[model samples]
Target: MSAAHDLPTTARPLSPEQRAADLRAMTEGELDVLVIGGGVVGTGAALDAVTRGLRVGLLEARDWAAGTSSGSSKLVHGGLRYLEQLDFGLVREALRERSLILHHLCPHLARPVPFLYPLTHRVWERFYVGSGIALYDTLGGRKGVPGHRHLSRRQALREFPGLRADTLVGAIQYHDGQVDDARHTMFLARTAVHHGALAASSARVTGFLTEAGRVVGARVHDLETGEDLEVRARHVVNAAGVWTDEIQDMAGGRGSFGVRASKGVHVLVPRERIQSSTGLISKTATSVLFLIPWGRHWVIGTTDTDWSLDLAHPAASRADLDYLLEQANRLLAHPLTHDDVVGVYAGLRPLLAGESDATSKLSREHAVVSPVPGLTIVAGGKYTTYRVMARDAVDAAVAELPDAVPSSCTEKVRLVGADGYEADWNRRHRLAAEHGLHVARVEDLLHRHGSLVHEVLALLRADPDLARPLAHAPDHLRAEVVQAVRAEGALHLDDVLARRTRISITVPDRGVEAAEEVAELVAPVLGWDQVRAAREVRAYRERVAAERASQAEPDDSRADAARLVAADLRTGA
Candidate 1:
């Protein structure tokens, strides 16, 4: 994964001085766009605008994808549920983007998965469900991934024997893509950086640098270092999905559309506990629930409802959990329960425009506007169609720029890990033998890190101890933790656990017991002293404990308070 020296992969904290230097070089020597927020959409926008030959700088209030981006159902599907709502335009756009990621842009990161839609009613239900899935398949996205297949009861049972025999008469198994949402967002930011974009996490936009009623740039606080730095640009793009209005206000006023926060909660369980080869998608009375396959865990979620809780930490309430378990358990042969839950994660979706009465009916379509001079805000849109949103955001920003801007080149851009991934995968056995690890273990690392596995492998070569798996969570190698701290800009233990590796949610006890071990692993790379490391571990545990306690609460208000009580161990805190 070595590249030009401009994009260094070093074991050092990102500095405001370095960013300021880069910012100066960007604005004085070259300039086009400055994007705020580090979610998938913002990262995508940065990559898009920069590759279009614009000098770009992207800043995030927290880590990339720390907000809604990390808290997805982890599926890159075209929203099959949207089809029933007659949102053909939305579904088609997403399906097309899903194809681009699967077949081209990030083939390694986004891979197809099969999901069985079990039919409860006999003849009518089968036909109704079959037609919907048929359209889902034939809409013929930018196509390399497979199509949907109809299954008889016998065939469906063969595919997933865990379903209750009496519950479903037949099924339709359809294909969709999935990804590590947080990692993908991080990669997006990294790819943007690789292309000469100055991207920084934990850089919050406190106020707009305005003069004569126009946003010139932003006044940002480097949360980790405790310094305020001004980053100026000719045009500013606010791709802040959830906090679009907040940024708009900072830019001097609010926009025509308002972004409402909707909470989506997901629970994690051991993979084998599901007893299904294919994932499951079921209809709920109000919404839908998807059973997704994570690496070692099965992600069953997600409960969607409007949430006005603390934006940072959205806790899944007991009622929400009850609703999901009740819905999913309707057809399962073995019912899931509280004890089966290893982790609970809730993400807030920025349902923009606030135009719909029903949360499920709310649009995922994004809108871009220059609510004020020199500022562009792009909000809404599903995760699947982020590139489109990015492209749109850049187009609007281009209008504000006084000079000609190059056409976007990100459609052809591959993230660091995408290139040479299949070849490395084909040589998995050799990699395993060479590294003295099991072929399965090597394959896991290969898929997760792609060609960048060599980066961690290089670390292990430097220190053999890095090759040993973590004491608490044996699934992830200790080297990966160190690599995250060194190369991935993991500012804290919670960042490493919650988003970087997902060990916090995948493991039981929310990685409480693993916190100290992880703190020890990342300390040397991050230059953490005994006090810093211990404080990190303690903070992470307290956060997890607070989330756990919050889930036991009855409603969002109590849950929000409890989750906030943990005091956010993030770099911003």
Candidate 2:
């Protein structure tokens, strides 16, 4: 798949043994830098460091973005809420990055989305909001995103007819960008690898490798092969996000600073239930609930609260579910219930803990520290500013390197799909027509894969059999599954379902009936025998069943126990 786009090819099949050998070789060469964590920030750091002419390697315990990165609300915004707290520096920085991404980098992965912020009062409220939005526009250079437009009550009703007349006196419409967080993150990893950053997932970092009382590298476990690898480097940077403390403990440090995990949950409901083209941003008594347009579904969320649980897989409690429903229903014409919730996701935000009791007050400002001489830890930045965080992390590590590594140039390094996306996007119609695929379908692929759409289309062209849709989830084209395994580092069915395509939670059956077909598609690349293929498919189905069952459980303890069954099933596979 990657060959069509001229993307540098990874080995046809990525095996743990091959990965370990590569890591050991890089370490023996005494790498310039090694980044711990495979989330967006970590991957970004790898890209930044490598592009700056440093020999780099990245290690992740699970698949890319399996942690806090994939669990976000998926908005590329300047944290509008932070504006309320007078976080001018953060808002300005995030806004600049948001523009950089939408207008320059990853345009295909991130696109403009319109949202209406309803105003309950007229004169005073309008002036207050209008002024704030005006400042917001100035901060980002706005590009061409329409400046906030005021809408009268009747006009607002026409635009958002489903909203109760009592809810708003008017509205302010503005634009922000949204992204497929997991897909974009995967692309970052691939881009980093393309730029010569050694990237590996399903490889667990067992502990830090120290020399003379300083961390020099890490001892990683190849979960797939049950072997250990010692990767040595001059600088070890931690961009672990929420798992920052865990890595710090392995290195015998204080984590440089405290990190707090705040849980935010989102629910998916059918889009037809909401009668509006524009998304809605409403104020909750405490936080905010957004009813965003998510293709065929409306993503309504989220409840931000403190969480102390199995940080790996946070179970959304019964209370958490009810709280979200109660808040979101207040705006719906017909309130959503458990049945309307076809999918649910919970994400943890790794905020820098502050004096305030509230998580909302926690600083989104990121700090880079050489907690130990050889280790540079970066944490606490928003998604929009990931590139900036990465650049800073690489800069910190450069100071520790034995030889001076040139400054990061990733600010100009567009991701793999960014080049010529617009021109190719314009040609999508002609190409889709020639291929006998719907134009809308072509646009979807272009947006998701960007200029790399040709790579996926080539798979369909090579094998007409690959052009069909996934058996259960017709929304996803079959070629996409093959592409996921071949080029996108989807080594397992869970990787394909959960992050690569998000079919697991996006659909009601959690993609059970589609599992076998997906497994069949990936089997050729993964070299799985029939027994292993069947086991992969079955494990995915049980994972879905367990998640569905856990959601129905009355409380967190039951939900936690039930969720464990799913993990146990996957392990048994």
Candidate 3:
């Protein structure tokens, strides 16, 4: 392994200055590895490469985790459903990664979340489901969380009072992990930058640079500045998730495997709507439905069906919303209606194409293939095992290099906020007193930013006005808006509301009420004039309106058409 002293001494914020510097540095010299896509895996690959003492550059067409990464069920688990498919190895691997993420890697971002698996059948169901949960706990090595426990129908009712009496005779509670997927992915990108990787968002790879029919680099277009530049790299890793096939075409060759996009839609409702101490996960006919507990809301989802619509904006149709509601209503004592839904989001899963026509049955196993000498394409894996996928991609990219490269050391490298998280959490009350904030607010900051809460606090100290809570979105402080821009690389209003703070999904108006205030809050930091700031607020309102219209549509085609009516701020349609 490379010595720690060889890398940069301290971490740098993903501010505008750092972004401009990184973009210029990418063109000045040839990078050892250039990672396409700023989703979880791509950012992970960049971190892996940089920590291995390799020059790395990571580019994203939009904001980090703007794609499928931001729109996940937000669970880090062993895929308990996969064990029933008899894919024990995949389950074990995922479980191991889950433990690492919850315990060692990003403890602040990822943590234990318990779920109740209600059993309908009186005898056979209990035996089968209990055995599976047992195996799951064992497979994960019982490291980060506690073991599962079986409960009778009466006992289960005590734990989850909202469950219908006829739905299940008993329940088994098990532990998994949950995370804010967008923030976690952003942390990956920032950590990579800290480890000496040139990372930039709003930078799209337009084409591949080839010499002698071998891929050498990429032709990148800066979406923000509208300038085109060449980023040369000895090797490139395509971790483009759902758009993997399109990237292969740009490389002038096709890989051995094909990627299929499976759409998954999730709906967020107020926490009071679900009377459960723990989350609920029940098996559906096609796939499983998860009622994961977020801070002020319960995230219920999802449908597993083939989606060939807009790759960038996967719209959740009225049918999708109804399906989720119907599924959740089956177990709830008081059936939920469309009015209960606070927010809805749709995302595409890059499943590896297989013999089965069902997208749900497609393989979650990732494949790393080199269609060209200098390029490697990695696609199709669950979010929990991103580190393993990233490690494999970096391993493949380094194989072609002449110099002997160091192995990936990311397993031991904590994310930006992991270190001293426990200590900060322990003294959260003191922090709250010092910062002149409530203990609950300080605790929330600790959970979101971990030990890096101090950085956000610094912003509050610098500008006392930033400590005020957002008028419409009270859960998030105004300081978070500035922190998102100054540290987390948020360049647009959507980036802050949708990904950085999740104000877009947690609120009833889908952040429309908070959009103008948020846009104004970050305008100075982003160097946005009155015109630009107004444009951003207008664009955000249009986006919310388009999404609402899309959700009202009955099917995918109509929903996609409705969604496309609003032009993205970055692309302008």
Candidate 4:
């Protein structure tokens, strides 16, 4: 076994042994900041704080990005619609972050993706929409991506062959960044660990540890081992996203601001279903619809409606699916039905509640407040500006410390696997030759693991069978599953299929056929026997079944009830 000191700081693996060590460290020392939640904002806050030379500990109730972070539309662009809402500052901030993500932060994980906005009305609409995109380009600095392009009806049809000729008089194409949200969040947590911060997933913060009405730390419950630990810190940051209110209540007060949950659902269809080279974006009655081009699939989505159901499992009802299909069909020459959808996912947005009853009108602006003397609550921001949210949250926490701390410098800190990504991509063919794998396969691994592809290559060197692709999920190698457990902090089969590899959403069976194979592959690394492995597979299948049943329901209440039938394995329901 390699010693902790022997590994490169950027390459430190979040293996099971590392998790145990982190948990022990959390209990042993009083950290400078203790972060609650492991979503993008929370993990980003942990990374920001640790890099500022402060001792930090991050805790997540479930798997990393298991909630809202994993369920995003997977775009990292300035909200073009928000510009219509007259939010210029937010748009400018997000566009700057988008540029940083594509160029500096996680170049391997995020890249520029083009989207075409179909204009139905002839001259007026074209000028209006085209002007907004031009302004968007100006604010974005036109740095890492191309500026907007105006296409006539003939040109638009040529670019997107699947579009209906009658629906679009013209189109405007703009560029935005896209990423694997789950893997990006996991990388944030691991990057914090690399900077000497302690982080443990499946560790729920049950209550706040208070000292004479000032928040000090938290009472954490480890779902994996069923152990309760008291982690002490000088200050605590509640970056819980939609769960912000719940954490604030534990801190013993209603926070200064309120967070309302808005349900957004996305559906995945085969790439061939829409013969578009670029993505599609259109205006909806409530919000907007996006048809994003994911690998081998087109991700169409998003219905913005208020949700008051189960916060953990936001269900996508039949109405939600129909609404999305109805919107997408308005533009597509070939209408898509329910049969065309291979996968569906739902996520909740933590919108800052305003006077408007419609969640769509709620503000995406974030607020950072110290509810108590030492507890800081950061909530209500979009995914594109997570780094700014993290920086502001850490700034608030650092204010309460006795000594003066440095300002946020995360803009300069590249995430683990970001360094040397370009050089690795240039030499991907050589790597494939060395590993006796296809160059295409090596390229895929480079995108997912960046310069860290060498670590996965070592696995193939030791056990060549691991290089074989999974029978059901041919896009992913068996070695990827092993790496998910041994390197990425994946404790459950769902973590590997659903988050680490995305086999759950890409495959037709939603990873049901791959569950047993993935379970057996990671069992030894996780110290699970045959019975435990079988139990994990059974739990994953039940979860998939419940999700399917929920999608068939008519409304949110019924869908929530259907989804509740599958108990969470970590919590045992």
Q: Give the TM-score of each candidate.
A: 0.95, 0.95, 0.98, 0.98
lDDT of 4 at 255: 85
Tell me model 4's lDDT, rounded to 2 decimals. 0.92
- Estimate the lDDT of model 3: 0.92
The runs of at least 3 residues in candidate 2 whose Cα sits more than 4 Å from the true structure, single-residue gaps closed, are: 1-21, 568-573
Candidate 4, residues 97-196: lDDT per residue as tens digits? 9999999999999999999999989899989999999999999999999999999999999989999999988999999999999999999998998888
The CA lDDT at 510 in model 4 is: 99
Q: What is the lDDT, from 0 to 100, of the residue 258 in candidate 2?
A: 81
Instruction: Let me know the TM-score candidate 1 reaches against the reference structure.
Output: 0.95
Clashing pairs in 3: none
- Between prediction 2 and prediction 4, the one with superior lDDT is 4
The C-alpha lDDT values of all candidates are 0.82, 0.82, 0.92, 0.92
Candidate 4: clashing pairs of residues: none
Least accurate 10 contiguous residues by lDDT in model 1: 1-10
Model 3, 1-573: lDDT tens digits are: 011112221257787778989999999989999999999999999999999999999999999999999989998988999998999999999999999999999999988998999998978988988999999999889997989999999999999999998898999999999999999999999999988999999999999999998899999999999999999999999999999999999987689999999999999999999898899999889878999999989999999999998999999999999999999999999999999999999989999999999999999999999988999999999999999999999999999999999998988999988889999999998999999999999999988998888888877777788799999999999988888888889999999999999888889999999999998888777888999999999989999999999999999999999999997989978
Question: Residue by residue across 1-573, what tens digits does model 1's lDDT show?
Answer: 111112334222233334445544544542468899899999999999888877789888888799999999988878888888898888888888888888788876778888999887888988888898888877755387677887889999999988888888889888899988898898888778777788778788899878898888888787777877777788899998888878888776788888888889988888888788899998887778788888778888887788776787788888888887887788778999988888899998898755576777777888998998989999998898999999998999898777788877777898878888899999989988888889989888876787888877776766677789988888899878876766676778888998888888988878999899998877765668999999898888889888998999998888877788776654434
Q: How accurate is candidate 1 locally (lDDT)?
A: 0.82
